[model samples]
Target: MVVFFDSLQGVLVILVMIVIGYILARSRWFSPSSSQIIARIVTQIALPMYMIDTITKDFTKQQLAQLLPNLKYPVISMMILFGLSVAIARLLHVRKNRRGLFQSMFFNSNTVFVGLPINMALFGPSSLPYVLVYYMANTTFFWTLGTYLIQRDGEGTWKFDIFTTLKKVFSPPLFGFMIGVVLVLLDVKIPTFIASDLHYMGALTIPLSMIFIGIAIEKAGLRNIKLSRYSLGVLAGRFILAPILMSLLLWRADVPQLMKQVFILQSAMPVMTNAPVVAKLYGADADYAAIMVTESTILSLIAVPILMTLLQK
Candidate 1:
């Protein structure tokens, strides 16, 4: 009973923070423009600092060995699930543009900004190693596989500016990851003062991410988009079914118990914010992608708690 309550309490705290952001946005206390400004700060600065801080601490070869296998596992599973989603969309006779948008948004997730917070809350600092490992893998997949998928049905071909694509792959988070590897390899020690400073900056990830999410929600109004039973089911599949399928696969592959939990937790995160941006770039259904991002994020607040209880057990 106590265990269940504690878990519920932890989940509720995250929800409350999300709610606070939502209220602030809905109440017009923070204008949409202001939210975008803050989001830029959080995404570019705080998020990278958090990644650097989290990746630099206590990372070792042994930990790497334990973590790396599960790293690729979740992402590979995600690709498979996303492919299935596209196939499902086709079978439903969805329009090509809408299908493209659905595929992009359904597969992509807000891994850095939103996922880090949810995983950190559920697992703690001990989850850092796995988080970094997963980040490394997910980043690679995002650049290569995700980009290709986004471009496949749209303007840019997979062969378009491969070098530029690779450059994007090595963006801030991956840069932090590389620094972490150097530290691990050189056995360099960071002073507690510097570490503590980084930690302070890192702590902004959740609140700022929630605010960004709230702004997104406001931009993609609840009433502007229409939701149907089938669309709701796809959202459910993305949030619930995908995680369950991945969990079973991870278990079969003998991933570490804790790592499996993280993978499943990550899989359960809502559609990525970048999806809309990518869709817009490709001249795909950017608005639809945006709607998916907003809807899935709002839905995941409920879905994730249920996911936690199911996957953590």
Candidate 2:
């Protein structure tokens, strides 16, 4: 009962933040262009700083080393989920314009925006290391295969470019993770002032991200977000199929209970908030991607609580 209330509180807080954003956007206090700027800030600066601060402050070399062996679980699970997503997209006959969006939604969750806070709320700060482990796998897949899928679907072609894919895979957030790990492993002492500054800047990630989602929802227009065959199918895969698959994958794995719960909750998270940004940048169906992000997030208010509650049982 306590776990249920905690999970419910966490979900409600997120929903309230998102609602605040929506109201601001709807009232014209925040323009659509403002969302673009916020996205850049979140992705380029806030997110990376958050990664560095969280990892450096909370994790140690030995703890990281311990996490290394268990890292394979998230990576393998993500890979399998991505493959299954592709198959499902094809089976659903999701239109070409939205095909990549569909597949990306399935695998790349809003790990940072929604996943981080919920994990902390439910499992406490000690779960940061495990959360980062999942982040590594999520980032790896998003930049490489995730990018490739969106690009291909957007372009309506299968032209492969190894160099391009490699470039995308080593994104700024990934660099932040790598640098944090290196610092810990090398036992490099970051000055107190610098660490404090990073934390201050990093603190913007969650609010900014939630606001961005709200702006996206306003732009997508709530009334327009109907349950089309495509949207319904994507939602089913995201909220229903993905969680079950992740649970089965981790059922027999020998990991901490918290880690398994975190992983499963993350798997059940809404589609990545950045999905539309990536879709737009890569010439995929930006409209469809935005709708998916917004709809999944709104629906997650209900879905995530129920999912977490059941997991506790």
TM-score between candidate 1 and the true structure: 0.87
Candidate 2 residue lDDT tens string, 148-181: 7888767555566778766666767767877888
| The candidate that achieves the highest TM-score relative to the unseen native structure | 2
What is residue 88's positional error in candidate 1, in angstroms?
0.4
After superposing candidate 2, which stretches have Cα over 4 Å from the reference?
155-158
User: Whole-model Cα lDDT per candidate?
Assistant: 0.70, 0.81
Q: Poorest 10 consecutive residues of model 2 by lDDT?
A: 153-162
Clashes of each: 3, 0
Candidate 1 C-alpha lDDT tens digits along 1-313: 4545655666676777777777777888876478668767776667677766776675575776566556567667777877787777777776665665565555556677677777777788667666666666666666666666666657645576778877777776667666766676677878999888878987887788877777677777888667865466468667866787777778777656777777777777777787777777877667777787878877776776677666645
In candidate 1 the C-alpha lDDT for residue 236 amounts to 66
